[model samples]
Target: MIAFPDEAAGCPLTGIVASYTPRLAALAAEPGFVAAVDQHAAEIRERLFAQGPELMPRPLRRAELTDYALGFLDALAEVGWDQPVGYDYAVDRLTAICWLVHQNGLLDA
Candidate 1:
């Protein structure tokens, strides 16, 4: 039997994929998803400006902010969450993942 994941266990990306994937598209799509993506991406910009984008081998440029955020949301929308209802939930998870990945560099390799 298929088991739906809880809030924290599943990544935001999973939620994105679940809702938008061809195998399972969201019954209701969220209109605010684009705005949410912009908001999330803006946060990345602020962070990069404040500290630095030296997470990679070489330093990243400030212009990469929008692209990264767009890519991130697009990735989640395209491959992670799949439900319109899960947008906010995905945002919560995205916030954590963003902080972990960018701020703390927890996901940095």
Candidate 2:
């Protein structure tokens, strides 16, 4: 069994999806980022959550979570989703999502 000290053991993908939603919302509010990001990411992101989030064996610290969220957002900025990016971007997104879950925090911070 997993034991966290006075903390929630949340799912990482959910946090990323939540965070992505807000960023997407804000970006959509932008002049052209919306169509660009959507045209770029819609289908690729569909595969992002295909099997749900893969959790970490150990609980994450707040800083770790923040780093993860940044990693994901960075991947979005760098990859935009449809093109071929190095696997580093994929690793960042996946790790960041799992970290977000462990921290029980959204990508907002």
Candidate 2, residues 4-109, lDDT tens digits: the string is 1333344244445543444434453564544444443433334333443664233334554444445554556675654233223443344334433434544335
Clashes of each: 16, 0
Pairing residues by index, what is the TM-score of model 1?
Answer: 0.28
Q: Please write out the lDDT profile of model 1 over residues 1-109, one tens digit for every residue.
A: 1122331242343333333333122213543654555465455556555563664433445235334444666666566565454556555435433432343343234
Which prediction has the highest lDDT against the true structure?
A: 1
- The TM-scores, one per candidate, come to 0.28, 0.28
Q: What's model 1's lDDT at 86?
A: 50
What's the lDDT for all of these models?
Answer: 0.43, 0.42
lDDT accuracy of residue 21 in candidate 2? 40
Give the CA lDDT, 0 to 100, for residue 100 in model 1.
Answer: 29
Backbone clash total, candidate 1: 16
